[model samples]
Target: MIKALAAKAHTYVVLADGSVPNPTRNAPGALTGKVNTVLGILAWAGTAAGVAGVLITGAMMAISMRRGEGSEHMGRLGMVLGGCVLVATAGPVVTFVFG
Candidate 1:
């Protein structure tokens, strides 16, 4: 009990003097920003891939439909495949944003 009281008193003394343990850190370090930039580039690339997939898929759908029944299924398959590619792109985007 005495030890506990002494510890509390010591903390109070420090507080009264306006001193804190582990002062606010000002340095983010050099590497932190560089790492962020690298991740940002990767994220942009992934987003670009998603956009390309969606556009290519849409184009394939249009061309297939114009070609008639023979290509209609192929066009639809392409669209579905493109959607998958786009959805997959989200993972990298999130990693970049949150990482």
Candidate 2:
């Protein structure tokens, strides 16, 4: 049964027309300027948010250190640094994951 199913899967064409599958019939076309503008705005907003988060985290880390918190300060510093790394590599990470 497993072999028969595997054979069928290997031989199947999901679209009866045997043409390239286009799953985005209703999707926004890539040629539209509005899509690009919206995407750019969103990207900039995300970057700004990440910068704000880093600033806030740094302030918290400073306060923690001023209070003589060794471990907690280190943890906060690590978190802010990790966030920076993630934001910096998000595009590549997404591409790698999707591709």
Candidate 3:
């Protein structure tokens, strides 16, 4: 049974031209501009949000520091900075990998 199954699989795997098929890479049409515009808007919004997060976290940290609780907000600040890094790198990373 194993031998028969292997033979069947071999037959199916052998293509008529012995070449692998490749998909056509075509540019996105019609809605491409609209899609790009939306992506740009989202990117801008994300950057703005990151800036806001950092500013808010900084204010909180400052306030907490006055109360001698500064260390507690360090984690929140780190997270906000990390998010900013991610938002900044996401587009370039995606383009580098895909293109």
Count of steric clashes across candidates, in order: 0, 0, 0
Evaluate model 2: give its TM-score. 0.48
The reply for model 3, stretches above 4 Å from the true place, is 1-23
Write candidate 2's Cα lDDT for 16-96 as tens digits.
Answer: 548664444454576556866875686677778778877887788787678888656567657767776776687677669
lDDT tens digits by residue: candidate 1, 1-99:
999999999999989998856666565778878877886787677667667666776777677678774555565556667666766676677779654
Please give the range of 10 consecutive residues that has the lowest summed lDDT in model 2. 19-28
TM-score comparison, 2 vs 3, better candidate: 3
- Give model 3's TM-score versus the native structure: 0.69
- Alpha-carbon TM-score of each model against the true structure: 0.46, 0.48, 0.69
Pairs clashing in candidate 1? none
In model 3, the Cα lDDT at residue 7 comes to 92
lDDT for model 3, please. 0.85
Error of 3 at 48 (Å): 0.6
The positional error of residue 99 in candidate 1, measured at the CA in angstroms, is 7.2
Q: Write down the lDDT of every candidate, Cα atoms only.
A: 0.71, 0.70, 0.85
lDDT (10s digit) by residue, model 3, range 1-35:
99999998886786554866565767778687787
